[model samples]
Target: MKYLMPFLGLVALLACRGKNVEGKNMGKEIVEIKKENTSQGVDTLSQEPRLKTFKGLADTTFVRLADFSDGFAFDLRYATENNFLKAKVYDCAECYTRVKTAKALIAANKDFLDKGVKIKFYDCYRPNSVQYKMWEIVPNPQYVANPDKGSIHNKGGAVDITLVDMQGNELDMGTDFDYFGKRAYHDNTDLPEEILANRKLLKETMESHGFWSIRTEWWHYNLSAASNDKVANFKWECND
Candidate 1:
């Protein structure tokens, strides 16, 4: 009986060994198949190529005045009348330049705010969509290119502005924003001296802060370091 028990144990051990060997052989076969498939460039997990997408397009880091001040009053009616579409209507809140430049301008020129030389921003922090609209309204010889192509305003690098006297009067720009006419030109001698001087001061002050004026538009100032290569679809928040 003792000898029989020993024999049975040996048989059970041998059967387990054989099953393990078979399992190892099956695993080896699977590994080899995978290797062969990979070598043949037959990727089992088929994946599509990565699509091209605009990066950081919706960066609303710029500002809107309502977020900072309850006294923020934007001329939505005037803006619409002028054909200037506001993507985020109030003011550029996240825009450091929007806030800093105004503050700096005020700091340097104390009378800027008190004297009724109030800064009226025609457009700021425009999204790519509004740019496209501008292009649709007028393309080509128009320097305001398609946002799909590239726009200075869309990059948060450009601003369209005007100034008012102490009585809250709007300056007499030769032509309004989006005026597809020769009157909008910087060298338009047809405009009055006061108008020209107003334009020049705006240009000089902005240029001092590293901004450049567009020859076609007296009120437009392009900020330095704005990426011309990248297009931003970013929308500025009116309040935040």
Candidate 2:
């Protein structure tokens, strides 16, 4: 919702207090809204976070996902020592994506929510510098992208993610994030029915949103239109 300035004088706007003038509001109420009352929309002034708007942001701008919506969960393994690298490389645990990627993710997540699950991000928008660190640990180009050319992650258009129930329990997708084996391959359908179903759900949903998964990693996805985008080392500021 927009925080509209009272353009007309108090007496003029008295009866139309909760209305929009033609030159004023974008069809929303032109009144002060209590932050607590906004259960389903963005509230920029609220101490409690409401979903934020992407009004003025560029499509290429990097943004924190948390600032947009509280509908998703994050378990950033790279920020901790839990990833395959077994090294903590990030300054903090935060999920960011390019505006286009973020928009696509948000749309896909809404679809997931309708299926009683939501998107849980493991990694998003890795810095090119972090790509170098990952390459140092695992020099294999197959497993880790060479930092010189940079990965889609460095371009802010790739993410490692999974599905979680509303209760925050993960859907079993055969292998954990970053599992480097045939078991992790998307083509490995020899697994149980439940696992294949989970993988199918994730793959189809993401693909519908302009994302494509790599054959080796069921959890990895790249925004189809963002592959040729330039790599960036845009680091986010961590709160104290």
Q: Best by TM-score, which number?
A: 2
Q: Quote each prediction's TM-score.
A: 0.56, 0.81
Q: Tell me, by lDDT, which candidate is best.
A: 2
Where in model 2 is the C-alpha error above 4 Å?
1-47
The total number of steric clashes, by the backbone 3 Å criterion, in model 1 comes to 12
**Candidate 1 wrong stretches, greater than 4 Å:** 1-60, 65-73, 76-81, 84-111, 141-143, 227-229, 236-240
lDDT of each structure? Answer: 0.60, 0.91
Give lDDT tens digits, candidate 2, residues 1-240: 133445445557665765545436643444434433565466655566468899999999999998898899999999999988999999999999999999999999999999999999999999999999998899999899999999999999999999999999999998899999999999998999999999999999999999999999999999998888999999998897
TM-score of 1: 0.56
Error of 1 at 128 (Å): 1.1
Residue pairs with clashing backbones, model 2 = none
